[model samples]
Target: MNRPSIARPRRPRNHPDRFLECQRAVEDTVVSAIGEASAAGWQKDEIIAAMIAVADDMQLALNAKVLLSVETELGKLMKKYR
Candidate 1:
């Protein structure tokens, strides 16, 4: 018996051009940072660690923002329903 495949929800295709520009800027910054680090004689492990640290910090900030947004929406919903 063959299993049925599930259809995944597709992402919307209406993202703004600013997002693309921001993505390109981030890519360029990462590339430049890697090149500079290498030129400064940073070890492979050191570069990897620095990148991970930066990523972790960004993740924390994003998580906090998401949490705050969720809480604000929940408050609005509660007020509306009450």
Candidate 2:
């Protein structure tokens, strides 16, 4: 069976752009959501749900461009990556 591969963002490790920066950005958003939810007496699951929603949006936006240009889903998927 062919499994869908997840896109892994990689910034320059040696240069100023570090791959972990992307990870950090995602964490920061999640943290901000959690803090706001906590301040408003909202459940922690709300933050998790928001994060998942944001991830889907991000993926759609990121993939939309390549999705239009490529012929096959595999090709679009490959180009959407890096």
Candidate 3:
């Protein structure tokens, strides 16, 4: 049996509006994951630490400015959820 191929949406590299759309998609996914983790009894610190680890892994792909932004936002989120 052969599985059907899934078609992924192609995002335009230079489109300003597409960038916002992608950001919103990422935000939604992260929020959903956090909620699921919380429901699964993960502590707030654990969740935040997991996110930090993910960010650390992403360092190779992210610029310094973006990494700083992510860290700053994670700090804010950690405080908000505490």
Best candidate, lDDT: 3
**TM-scores of the candidates in the order shown:** 0.53, 0.48, 0.46
If ranked by TM-score, best first, what sequence of candidates would result? 1, 2, 3
lDDT (Cα, tens digit) per residue for candidate 1, span 11-64: 345656655655554665666677778878997678978998999999999999
Clashing pairs in 2: none
lDDT of 2: 0.69
lDDT of each: 0.74, 0.69, 0.75
Off by over 4 Å in 2: 1-17, 69-82
Question: What TM-score quantifies how close candidate 1 is to the native fold?
Answer: 0.53
Q: Candidate 1, 47: how far from true, in Å?
A: 1.6
In candidate 2, what are the lDDT values of residues 1-82, reduced to their tens digit? 2223334557665857565666665665557657777778877887678778998999998798777666487787888996
Taking all chains together, the TM-score of candidate 2 against the true structure is 0.48
Number of residue pairs clashing in candidate 3, backbone atoms closer than 3 angstroms, sequence gap of 3 or more or interchain: 0
Off by over 4 Å in 3: 1-11, 61-82
Residue pairs in clash, model 1: none
